[model samples]
Target: MKGRVIVLDHIAGREAAALLVDGKLTDLLVDDDSAPRPGAIFRAVCDRPIKGMGGMMLRLPDGETAFLRQGKGLALGQSMLVQVTGYADDGKAVPVTDRVLFKSRYAIVTPGKPGINISRAIRDDDVRDRLLACAHEAGVAEGFGLIIRSSAAEAADEDIIEDIAAMDALATAIMADADGAPEALTEGDGPHVLAWRDWVEPAKVVTDAGGFEDMDVLGQMVSLGQPRVGLDGPAFMYVEPTRALVAVDVNTGGDTSPASTLKANLAACRALPRALRLRGLGGQVVIDMAPMSKAHRREIEGALRSAFKTDTVDTALVGWTPLGHYELQRKRERLPLPAEVMEALA
Candidate 1:
């Protein structure tokens, strides 16, 4: 409870992983079998261009259509490789990208981008040099780029080199299959794999059966179903999701001091990222912060920025709206918690 713990288990027959820090559920990954997962590579055929949207539709071998924005100059019936970027909304085509990447725990292989780069977080000169050496030793193919992830800083030299080699080989194999008909080249990493890949920090790993129950992960997950998230300063926030956007309402529970509004707003900013992450909520987010003076807007903005800086999801803080609401645009990287998952936990 005082440190980090990773719980790998099955929920409702789906593979799942949960990260707990200081006894609190910090992050979660659950498999969604219904849709093509993000990071899945496919050789798709160009269908038709939607000039009005500045994008094109693609036809996959499974008879599903994907939307690729900024896909210009793709002639009809032409075969090209694409990667699923995120899940689609109801009745919408899955979003795909032309820029496909092969990612692993220690290295990421970029096909078109040719260069060897180190993570900026690894500031030690010796570490950076050693990581660069590892990348060079792995031997990146021509027209491909290698990125040494920050996790490689503490990893063994051989392990880093091996990871790089594996990713490079995978990218080569996938690219070579682009000449064929539209079909899925490779599926994305599942929950357990993603947990190991992304949650690289020091933590106790639990893989035994009933580990979720033993670690109280199921109890914590139950709370995620509710919209209420308690914050510091005795504040609270309701993170409700609707069809259009996620609406967050912050309130100062029992604090009536003159600084209550600002305190509650800042607390909401700090707790928001985790709440959204656990809920698997994304897309448009409108935060109706507790009533505060306009002078404190910059401070709230700074708090929001600091809060989401470490979050893994792609989020854009769009600043305050005219109606005193703060807006955020988040990428739908994770699917919403399905009903079956909650039932299984229960």
Candidate 2:
């Protein structure tokens, strides 16, 4: 649950912002004060004969040039429209495009840049018109253009407005050389908050042992309400895995039973996904789940899905794999849950 923010100038006159809390990228704010983009149609001009390829390197009217693949009969100064597919999510670098030679739309990804060319709305409209139309469709209010982020997919219009303003302000300040302001746009709030806020009512704070000061805020919020208490167990557990066998001893305090074991198992399953997110688990992770019951199994599965819904970054539950347990693979980038979670677990 802990993270930090960094700001830098990216676009010609815009600031690029990245928020990484708990080592995971929570927000990306770009294109706050710069020109919308080179969102226009242009004709490619033969600049110079490309050394190896037959077609010359074509210069675009918008001032970008890329090599047009040889032979398919494109000539010098040909007129056509190019749309942005995907550009750098960071606002500073503009996107690049290629002439639509194929019937299907294609994205022109520039090397060393996050440029993606989206197919234009209409082949006939001017570049600016298509850009504005796309912006309008995405609900960008003014002359400002934006690359709607993944976080905004389900947000209300107001949240989107708030985010866009945060991005705009941050970007403008970056350009004006006045950047040191505390940011209001945090690493994007994932569905976790929404889930934790909406679904899992804080039953109570569970502690691994004596350390609970780190969770002071959460504890305080739920202070008025009663929370479930589990146990203050051993410092850790050692899981032994032979080439094919893994032995896990379900160690609780003095009192351990089938019901308590199931409860602890359910609790961990419910918390594990969110905990995994909080820790920012990366790449292939094999959690040797301790065994549990059939009826309890459904509840654990449901809870796992609910907790993970809030993840802002990409993750997938392939369900339980061929192994004895399920598999959770993080996209490998970004941070996972913080260590404090493991420290705080009861």
Estimated TM-score for each candidate: 0.98, 0.34
Q: Distance (Å) between predicted and true CA of 160, model 2? A: 6.2
Give candidate 1's whole-model lDDT: 0.93
Total clashing pairs in model 2: 31
Best by lDDT: 1
lDDT of 1 by residue, 278-309 (tens): 98999999999999899999999999999999
Q: Per-residue lDDT for 1-346 in model 2, tens only? A: 4434222223223223333445443333333221222223233345565557564555544454544445246544453333332223222222334422111011111212222233343243454344334334433223333543333333355544454455445433322331222211122222222222222222332223322234332232121121222223421222332233223223334445656655555555544443333333344445444555555656756766776676654556655645546555545233322233323332
Residue 310 CA displacement from its true place in model 1, Å: 0.4
Q: Flag clash pairs in model 1.
A: none
lDDT scores for all predictions?
A: 0.93, 0.37
What TM-score number comes out for model 2? 0.34
Model 1 earns a TM-score of: 0.98
